[model samples]
Target: MKKKLSLLVLSLILLLSTSSSIFASPSGFTESELDTIFEKAGTPQELINQMDYYTKLFIVENSGEDFEFSSNSTSLYKFDSTLDTFIEVKETDIQPLGYIPSTDMSLSMYTFNVTVNGVAMKEIYSQFEWLNKPKDFPAGIGKDNLGIALPGGYEIQSGRYACAVQTKLEKNDAWGAASSSRCTNQSPVVNNLYGAVWEFSASQNYLNIYYKGTVKLTARTVSSNPVKRAVSRYSQARENALGNYGVSIGIGAASISYTPKSGSNDTMDADTNW
Candidate 1:
């Protein structure tokens, strides 16, 4: 009887997943309901393994707190875990996500948070979804586009980007990204090569909105500390994220996306095709 109920509950989740409109765990998918289901499946992470890509099952410890998740309408802030705190946060200043990146690197890689009109959010990241990256870039070009190569005695051309094989890439159709020419004002930008859709962490609330802005690239510098390198990298990333990458930021979103521990056999893959 318990097994039958589990299958019935799963069918309902699959049914809800097909809807185009976003919902916060569905109107009546209360914590008690989820707890009952998950108790059968094992851990929350284990439950994710049995589901298809992008299919989310939110779990809540508080049965009466009214936990929810949904995305629609464009706003500076898209979530309110407090049930409705979609307002700017307090006198909080944006700080590095953790200990600042080492001051001895030459590539950009750091994280921080900021508030707009008081709404607090953190910068996600700026990088490719692996599938969109060139299968085999030149030796010096980093797929992440975070490094500035200086091959010995080779001419330092303007910062370069990696490109994938023609046949392997999705065609420049309506699904492909808009032409890079659309933003003549931005530098160090790359087209998604795919349109309307974006790669995101499935565990977070799908805010699905973006902000655009420009960022200046790092001029040639003699700095060797990782701090300087990290700063330049993050600044460019944040700005380009606002401009080209469409950095997704919001409050109440949890890092539910699972990251396997080292040496694990999980072949982490993105949930997109073509």
Candidate 2:
């Protein structure tokens, strides 16, 4: 009986040693298999811990600073070439708009203060809302309030709510509009919203979490306002793709003008199987 029991124990050991190869999946497996399978591997706590570690690694590698993740909610950031550095700016900072994360947020002066390899950096972003001129205005009297302010004597006549995202160097107050999106070393995947409204921006290294999300302005536009009426609804199919932007950082950028409030749904690449 003792000899038989020893043989059975040896057989169990052999199975345990070979389990990895036995269960190993071949190449070309679908992505869904990864999100589901690995998540099923360990207990809830173990998964959380693994996720937390990976999140930190990703942040540090890209931003060159330590990244802090939260259990509840947090604001995400991106690097601005115009700003020359990265910053996490909350719209609530300048205005008392009520959508700040529960925790108190602070602005960083790194863009103003730091330089890499002799090149200066810009950090903070200055947001602007689109204010198109009313087409119905009297022939002589134009609709654009910013006619004198903007270039070429052209008013904000693009009733399509053209929200031009602008930023200033923390070193100085010279602000420039993001005339063209150029962060990831590639052409912008989608044509910026041709219609009046747009929000958020993305790069190859870091993509806006909101798939359909556009470059956000500091303020919101009134959909009911006569001057800023939408001609057509937002319709861009490529916005739903994940392959376009390799990695992602979710910015829960929101505006009171468009609500129920929205946030980014980020899929971290920490899962090796994916």
Candidate 3:
């Protein structure tokens, strides 16, 4: 009886060890299998991120009175292949706008101070509603109804930094006339009612806006007024994508406008997967 029990124990131990060794082996993905995956993973969006890094940089040219980017929310991320995460590289809600480009030459400067309508200037918020939100804006907003005043003593680039503004349009009856002419042909990918605007300016600096095509502004207010507007760049992108993989940052550069409101979207790259 004792000998039979010993044999049973040894057989069980051997069976467990063999099972573990089978899983521990590299059969699932040998060097050859990994090569196949690398060869098969050829997609356009992946190519763009590899080639250009596709990161768009926009400095907060105007810091009007309103919401500010929360400390935990402001971040820069780079996609990590091994971990499949957008690793945060730099983050700061308090970082002031820097690398402000001159309106005349679009030349980026390193240091400067900016004010709006005599106010010393705070952070840029896309709209007043974001300040009232329970969570505040998950994403930082843009500033409007203000002029960027660069105190002459400081250089332009020192105070500049890049940020992304998410925008949404409330296509109510009021936008009827302008929407037809400006947005009728918008790509189905963009909400058409929303777009992102990236601008750069310094204290008393000039800004020139160029529309890809000639845009006839029926009313100056129609283009400049910040009404029925909200910033939700990622939100709109997600919505437009439906349930598909959706867009991640570094996909491509989004084309934008400068009139404070109502911009069109353009494809930065042909590859949607990016």
- lDDT tens digits, residues 1-274, model 1? 9999999999988888754233234445533455454444343444334322212221231111232221111111111336732232222433233211222111111122323234332221112222232222111111112211111211212332221111113323112221222122223332221111111111112112121111211122223421111111111121122222222311111111112122111111111000
Checking candidate 2 for backbone clashes, the offending pairs are: 83-122, 84-122, 133-156, 160-196, 161-196, 199-214, 199-215, 200-214, 200-215, 200-216
Least well predicted 10-residue stretch by lDDT in candidate 1: 265-274
The better-scoring model by TM-score among 2 and 3 is 2
State which candidate, 2 or 3, has the greater lDDT: 2
Candidate 1, lDDT over the whole model = 0.23
Measured on C-alpha atoms, candidate 3 has an lDDT of 0.22
**Model 3, span 1-274: residue lDDT tens:** 9999999999999999885543222224332333333234332233223211111111111221121222112222223448853344333423222211112111111111234344332222221111111111111211111111211121222222223222223312111111112222321122121222222111111111111110110001123322321111211111122222222221112222222123211111000100
TM-score of candidate 3 relative to the true fold = 0.16
**TM-score winner:** 2
Candidate that scores best on lDDT: 2
TM-score of each: 0.17, 0.19, 0.16
Tens-place lDDT per residue, model 2, 1-274, is: 9999999999999988776344233332233333343344322344334322222222222223321211111232333348743344454544223322213221111011123344332111112221221112111111111100111111222212222223332323323323333222122222221212333443433221111111211112223332211111111112212323122212111110121112212110000000
Off by over 4 Å in 3: 1-72, 91-184, 190-207, 210-274
Structural RMSD, model 2: 20.9
Model 2: lowest-lDDT 10 consecutive positions: 265-274
